[model samples]
Target: MKDRYTDFKEDPRFKIANREALIGCGVAVINFIWWFGFAYGLGSKPVDTYTYIFGLPAWFFYSCIVGTVVIIGVVILMVKKGFKDIPLNHEGGDDL
Candidate 1:
């Protein structure tokens, strides 16, 4: 039997995977913070029927509509600039 244990940190695939995961986590954390701040922090204020934003509550407008658009744009930009495609398989080499 041969030992399969090896230093994975030195592998390119490992590094790429880690980088991608960190980027994903960062996006998630930002979204969570934004949502929590708007939903709980700002939206907790006393309700007023007189105030309207786009025919909706100010909190809903910022937290759902605007936040979604901003998050979409952010993800698109991150994917376009932050990630490199790795081939799933290489000719005469082991499958990824």
Candidate 2:
């Protein structure tokens, strides 16, 4: 009997993948907090007076429109700065 499972800790690509995964998770968490906080936190305010932003509620504008733009920019920046391109054939690996 032999240990069949490979240890990912010894693989060079493991660190890169781990870093990218962490960045992706962080982005997801930030987006979740931003949207939820705006939708529930701000939308729950008193409606005594009508407040409109571009014919929509301020909460909707900030949560959906503005948040989307900001998230897009953040994703682009993360990909450019945090990711590296490794050639698939460098180690005789099949190109998928």
Candidate 3:
């Protein structure tokens, strides 16, 4: 092992951080796609031709209500299963 240094080239924490960042970006992109697809797909129709679910527009119900529930569940599941709560301390160093 190399001597004590604040910065290291092969730190495993870097990998974890990069992976989590990518996951966050991917989740954001997926959320945007879901909102856009439903909003445009259903909202594009004539107002009088639109259908209502629970007194909300089809697009609003599907994109906002259902999407929020689904996305929250997905994010919770991902954080619980895919993420690691790594300690933010250096190797052989004092706690930070």
Candidate 4:
């Protein structure tokens, strides 16, 4: 296979796709944390204060929900379109 950076720039969609993929990955992480916190915390809400980056308690809670949805949506978009042609790198070319 070819080196990713060498060939990725050839596609004009690469930049936009790269940005979307990064955003999508970030969303996925945040979503995973939100789910983990929700399952573990059991309805105990996130607090908003000087420690909180968003604003208020309600904002934090709603943002988590929205983040979850956006993350999943972006992931779907990435997997369905952005990565359709990328070959997977593997060891031994068979084990994976």
Candidate 5:
């Protein structure tokens, strides 16, 4: 039998990290908005537990959940796109 898939990119591609980072950035934005709203819209009061990164509220809780889901979804999508090792050759080895 032959392996169904191979490594994505010759070595491990940065796609996974890139996707996770992208997702984290996005989540950060959302968190910023959420905190900004709470801070400015609701009141200029900052939460005691969390501190600001650059004078902005740190929405840690929300970021964790949303970031994880977003990153996993992105990685799964890349995998579905045949991002894994290239199609195997008939000679029983993966084609470069």
Candidate 6:
């Protein structure tokens, strides 16, 4: 059976918004996994045995610096390509 809010759910704006939100969440999850994997997986080693890259520990460089760069690039790409600029007005009738 059709729900009362079916029309609202099927609207293109909602679809666009849902897609954008999903994209954002997906990126966040990917970034988190990347950072956690490097920070813990590689960083678990003894400090004396740690590898260096550009004068920083390999895990620190990858997890903190590279992860930051990757997430920023993803966000910029999403904003330029994936996100939409939807209007804020539902209607004058719905205004307070």
Highest lDDT model number: 6
| Ranked by TM-score, top first | 3, 6, 2, 1, 4, 5
**Residue-level lDDT tens digits of model 5 in 1-96:** 236565333333455556656766765676566555544553444567556555554454335444456556655764666344532355446666
Give the per-residue lDDT digits (tens) of candidate 1, residues 1-96.
235675333446767888989999999998888777776666777886335687988777777888899899889988999887875454337955
Backbone clash pairs for candidate 1 read none
Overall local distance difference test of candidate 2: 0.83
lDDT of 6 by residue, 8-68 (tens): 5565677798899999999999899989999998899999999999999999999999999
lDDT of 2 by residue, 1-96 (tens): 236575433667767888899999999999999999887776888875537799988888888988899899999999999888865464747776
RMSD of 4: 10.3
Tens digits of lDDT, candidate 3, 1-96: 457784557887888999988898888898898888998999899999999999999998999888898799879977998788887877746965
- lDDT (Cα atoms) of all candidates against the true structure: 0.78, 0.83, 0.87, 0.58, 0.53, 0.89
- When summed lDDT is taken over every stretch of 10 residues in candidate 1, the lowest stretch is 1-10
Global lDDT of model 6: 0.89
Q: Worst ten-residue run, lDDT, model 2?
A: 1-10
- Residue pairs with clashing backbones, model 5: none
Q: What is the TM-score of each candidate against the true structure?
A: 0.78, 0.79, 0.83, 0.36, 0.34, 0.81
Best by TM-score: 3
**Model 2 misplaced regions, further than 4 Å:** 1-9, 89-96
Give model 4's TM-score versus the native structure: 0.36
- Give the lDDT ranking, best first: 6, 3, 2, 1, 4, 5
RMSD of 5: 12.2
Q: In candidate 4, list every pair of residues with a backbone clash.
A: none
